[model samples]
Target chain A: MPTDVRLPENDLLALALDFLLSHGLNAPQGHSLARMLVDAQRDGSFSHGLQRLPGTLNTMKHPRFNRHADPAPESVSPAVVRVDAQFGFSCLAAERGIDALIGKAGTIGIGLLAVNNGFHSTALWPLVERIAAAGLVGLSMNPTHAWVAPAGGTKGLLGTNPLAFAWPRKGKPPYVFDFATSAASRADIAMHRNAGREIPDGWGLNGQGECTTDPAEVLAGAMLPFGGHKGSAIATMIELMAGPLIGDRMSRQSQDFDHGADAAPCHGELLLAFSPDIIGGAGVGEGAERLFAGFSDQGARLPGDRRYRMREVSARDGIAVSSALLQKIRSQTA
Target chain B: MPTDVRLPENDLLALALDFLLSHGLNAPQGHSLARMLVDAQRDGSFSHGLQRLPGTLNTMKHPRFNRHADPAPESVSPAVVRVDAQFGFSCLAAERGIDALIGKAGTIGIGLLAVNNGFHSTALWPLVERIAAAGLVGLSMNPTHAWVAPAGGTKGLLGTNPLAFAWPRKGKPPYVFDFATSAASRADIAMHRNAGREIPDGWGLNGQGECTTDPAEVLAGAMLPFGGHKGSAIATMIELMAGPLIGDRMSRQSQDFDHGADAAPCHGELLLAFSPDIIGGAGVGEGAERLFAGFSDQGARLPGDRRYRMREVSARDGIAVSSALLQKIRSQTA
Candidate 1:
């Protein structure tokens, strides 16, 4: 609700894409990154939106970084595909490989895509939502450098691993939600830090491993897993799934390997897509109807409902980018 | 802990098996049920242990029950199999179908087994743990009758859905745990109810839709999801996955179909097994090592570490069942 620079949706996306092009990304890569950034801004995920542009641009500027490198994930098995992003962004890799995953699941019932040496810097809902839109159940896990301590432990040994899940709904927007196994994703914390706002209590631990509500302190310290030990365990599972399971950098290694700037962080992601026709088969519609009906009976809003509503408003009235952020993005291209 | 009657491991197994046989279960089912029950006791899951044996016995006696069913699941797609338990205990069916699931995951990169028309009474850890023991990543989700309320709402619109995950460790008991998406499972609530103990705060709601600590009130009302909206979304996903995706009962339908006095509540389960060699390929060992190393670095115990330690003790010293429960089993025999 601060003072803002409001532009039409097209102009916002065009400016964002043009900024990415200024950083030497190809049209396809620019479009991919811009699309995710715009959606995040539209849905009010400011940290993952325009606020992240400068850092991503600085990271991509490294001499060792190659935005155009297409690792071209290979079919490792009938239902497995592996992509070695080789210190590049996962944006294009995911865009390139999701179709293969969908096709494999269509044929074999389920498909898995392992992404290694990638830097994924967006809210992952869009990726899985795309898979859901393709009429398949989609689930994704992405691990970053460690910032979460194991439950009842002192060290930050786990990633604030984020997971996304989506399934198709009959004649409606697909049901979807993305969450970090940790109390909050780093991006959410960063947003709080930028806003100079206090985060909710119990959201994180301080450097001394004591609970604190200061977003700045949390950024310097660690995150608490959402549901105590259970959340920590899931974070562990996701860390492995995105890390060594894909022959990629583990959270610990990624923390050590972080260059601070001019390079995407070394990390990984895992995605699974399951076809309704193959897995749900004859009962697909019935299952969807039952799920929606129950959700309605409780007057419980479905997960994707928020994003769907936000998308419509953003498309119509456009998104509000702060004047400060707009000036910063423009300065980046200067 | 309640006073118990210590019995030798062999004697306990023998008595439990005999008690199951008295209810007319075949030798295979008696062995399976007894094995799971004994393991539950061994692992200190008393709620899922011998405490609920009488209810199971009575349920199996229902005229609508079919204990001798051999629901040999049919292979739907290469990576998918569907088992209709044909209105019987899932013990024998799971025991019979597990090998096939492991084999399929070994052949393909991933395998999915859907079990419908089944009453799964035991803790699901044992099933997924078996898959992990076979050197695969195992994930299982089962949905039961309604007991959980959606986040932001107070109706029991969802099941106390349980999810289990396991991954193998080199030269170690597999790392695994199973958890209800609800704050606590229905069985856990029932245990507290029987003990006349107050449930923990945030565990459930009263009939008037207000939070309460009374287990009786929760039983009459609803259980809250473990991690607010996130857990509720996952539970919703599990409910649909185990129901329509598997051609079985959704939470509402199952609640209505449940024969109050006889037969285990009709429900369904979904299982996925992913072979490390097939999915992770050459990185399998690295993945396990990285995961275990993280736990060790933090002096953190893996999820199932307690179960493994207890199993050793139980195997050596045997489990202790309550004298009253023993008398009840004996009474059944008489």
Candidate 2:
């Protein structure tokens, strides 16, 4: 039997906001952080939604991770900005960076912003979707803690580094795509392990580089690239761009998350936004509308259409959360 | 048995160049085209190397695919340029585009160039590697004829749609990576079919969407994405950016190759080049050197190191072509 429980979107957001505020986050920080988390839930990315709130709050309460730092943006050019997150919540820093880039793109047709020295910014889709909602295309990539292996290597050398791209469509939802280059995410493996299910071969390898179907082996070894060498190559490219390009430490050299002062893991993000009007000239807007309409008419759905539809359904009805997870959230907040 | 062959690198280049010139290409075009093809052979991509020469020459002899047309730079901006290929050979157009963007990137730290109305550009890696060799990071993506299926659809809604990226390293060949986003390339399946071998299940599907190991089924149906939905998503994003964004006809909508001028099979190419100086300021060069040294010290070879080594070997010992293919090439020119 499936567990059934419901929560109003506003009530859930308020509760999360209150929890963050009580945990010592500033008013603005608390609100933005809560809103981002709720948005993920509303968008149906439950893995990154309310499930991550407790972990985030715990990390904040730890003396090693600072919660009050504010990001300051440094300008390299009118089209480029770099922000120092000052060990603050990544949600706020990323939002500020996105806003700056979107503003610049509106004028120059394109802009690039990099955020260094930040925490894990959840669900990259929302960030790109936000830019798309403002009538612009967005591309973003970030490196996380090491969780996956290079193509032929058995050791963990790369993160489940996620890359996201969002394109604005005419009347339908924006074409938003967010994915980890890894064959299977750590979260997926954990879920399968908990359900006492065997994993598929080629999803990962045991510690000795031999392919394995044991979830426990994957957890202890390394996650595999999605499509062998091709996915591995893409992840490597992301590491070079999001890691070294942004002047942040690579995933393999990331600081230990358990140590006190060094416990705050620094994540690097690279974002690019552009307006087609600047390039396509007079026919840009109408052409885009016509193009998207053609896609829609041909039974082709945009990237984020399914998620957007799911969100609409949940909003009209109510959000369903596992009773166990709901109780755990209440316990932690209390 | 493989044919034994011996010739100096210069001798082979001269022979290839002469062959192209005799077929119809001008001096500059023929030279660049020959070098690109030989480079592919030297780098071990035999499929795109001299093996494809017979087909290329035959295609050029026909009026539909022009070899003498000039690839003129249409417009240039600080950060972007547009090129009209004049329906020229795609290899030469790509070479010109990469050269222009690399030069522009030296000033702006990043530059984008889009080429429209071009033919099948051979392997994308060489173009990106050329830009990377100029101390700039580069990426290129192009959409081709309909050959692969969308995520849920069984029909060919997308091209194999290859994307390539290269990063400049201080003391090593750029880390060049390139791949088609399909589960298995049509070429690979064709080879299997020619050898009377069964393809791996899930590599392709028949028109009814049923999995088939028969290579003939694939020829009549569509190739699947590399890693199912994940690869499909990446292919879709590539199509959106490289196809619609460039105002080019897409996939099935593109004109048939058999229809000649009436078949304006427009393919779109997107190039992005970035200079490390923009990110690291005065320390850019030194930083890249140190990073490359560290990776080397840790037993990590650069991405294209093997290919570069292979090229050196091939140069010292000439590349061998099949007698059958060589005979075909001679017949075409005769």
Candidate 3:
């Protein structure tokens, strides 16, 4: 059993920042990355939160991703922009890109930003929420390492590319949805493997392309695409849009972290922001509010409401962490 | 077993259109609707193909949706347009919106269109493909009737909101992807029911909100969101964007089809078009071609490649439809 720990949000953020700083990251980079990770946990996405810190730190220690690097924005047009991550933390690059896009959209009613040459940023929902809270609709997608199989094939060929969307609703939290195109995530498979459990059929395959229950074989082979070919096609679309659209390496170009020489993970992200006011003209805000009220009346709960409530409870009661994981983190920090 | 019936592509399309016309749809409307449905089947997406036509026809007979109605474009801006579906076939309205947006985007580089007061439009991929084939990037989303359950809850509160995106690629089929936010589509549940098969756990729930394998339970309850809360959030976001953003009734304000009331089944759709030539200033076409080639090298296959191949095969051979389904369709038409 793991003991529950109650730390103030700010305290947790500062501690994370301190750890990053000690690992040679500058103040701005440390704080930005810390905020992203902490926000993921705060949003109840623990898998992408502090749990991912160790892997990120390991990558940072390698010389390929320089902590001192800065992302520079390249303007393609009034409505389009691109950012070169310079092998830095993806969280920082994503934040800059999102902020710039939101600002540009505020002026132009729509904006597009593409980020290239970066690492995995935390959960994408927080970025969506940030953009949505700014009174704009946000759409984002990113391609990562290969984990998911195509619809019919059994071998891994595509990343569990995640897509996210956010919509602002008056008097309610903005609805934020983020998900991988895979039927099951690598984390879920890892959990099953940790518990020596068998995965459900159709979730993944063995190395020989046959269905497998053993978590290890499934992990060694490929995770199935959600809803079969539909999901595979969607994931492929994300890869093309995020990878090639932004001029970054795609899944095949990605280095196998387990066997290849350590290299900067060349991930890419695409984001679009649109203002409802611009589209709806004069009474857009009022229209949105009225629409949301109608949905509430119809017994519709906002998408993120439950997660938000769970996060609030967790914050108030403190988060629970596995004892072994907590000990590992403490040892690393010490 | 499905018996293969060879038919030329043109012949299959003509036959489908003829079937629709015999059921009281006007020539243009029937042609548009038939093309959309046949395109789905040709692309190997049997669920959204002719399988849905019978239900759609049944809904059309309710008098709320006027099969002969025509959509009139309402210009919101030089680069923005709105269309009232006149409670008619959404396939017609959606195609019209796509054409209008593409035309506007050709001049402005970006076009946004919203469609309201429409009926179900099958397979969003075709619209995206149309936009992509026109040398533009396209994004679309729609909100439908409640069929998806929220993350933790077992009750139906949202439609299986589908999203589609496409991008122009050089020397290859344009990338096009379409998928619903649900773990499984209502069509999949119906298929299981027809087969007298038990569904997998987590696909849906019973009327009492308890998980069950009985396909009948799913029909009475709700389909689960893909990836739990993440998928639910996406559905909610889609509802917000597609519903209110397009000025349609939100989920709660939506009328139930079970009531057999004469109210129109309102559907909302959002379409966006972006021209690379406008965004990429000089050498835009070359840049796009280069990007496409680079992505293909990275194992990024075009989204619609498989479907296009399937269609080619079916064109060379013929469409394979189950005897039972064909007989059922013939009886309904007879």
lDDT of each: 0.79, 0.73, 0.72
Candidate 1 lDDT, tens digit per residue, B1-334? 3636667777878988888888777787778888888888888777778766778876786666787876786787778887777777776677667777887888977888887777766889988889988888889987877888888777788888888998877787888979888988777788889989999997899988789999999989989998888888888888877777767788878767765754566787889888777666586676568757777776878889888887887777777678888888789773
TM-score of chain A of 2: 0.91
Instruction: Kindly provide the TM-score of model 2 when superposed on the true structure, using C-alpha atoms.
Output: 0.92
Q: Write one digit per residue (lDDT tens) for candidate 1, span A1-334.
A: 3527667777778889888888777776778788888888887767678777888866687655667766687887788887776667777778778888888888888888887777766888888988888888899987777788888765677887888888887677888888888888777897899988999976888888788889988878878888878788788888877776666777777767776653445677889988878766687767668767766776888877877887787778788688888877888874
Task: At residue B210, give the lDDT of candidate 3.
Answer: 78
What clash pairs does model 3 have?
A298-B252, B6-B318
- Give the total clashing residue pairs for model 1: 1
Docking class of 1: medium
Best model number under DockQ = 1
lDDT of 1: 0.79
Q: Which has the higher lDDT value, candidate number 1 or candidate number 2?
A: 1
- The positional error of residue B271 in candidate 3, measured at the CA in angstroms, is 2.7
lDDT of 1 at B266: 76
Q: Residue A281: error of model 3 in Å?
A: 6.3
My TM-score estimates for the predictions, one after another, are 0.95, 0.92, 0.81
List where candidate 2 sits over 4 angstroms from the true fold: A1-3, A61-64, A255-265, A280-302, A323-326, B1-3, B61-64, B255-266, B280-303
- Please name the candidate that would achieve the greatest TM-score relative to the true structure: 1
> Which is better, 2 or 3, measured by TM-score?
2
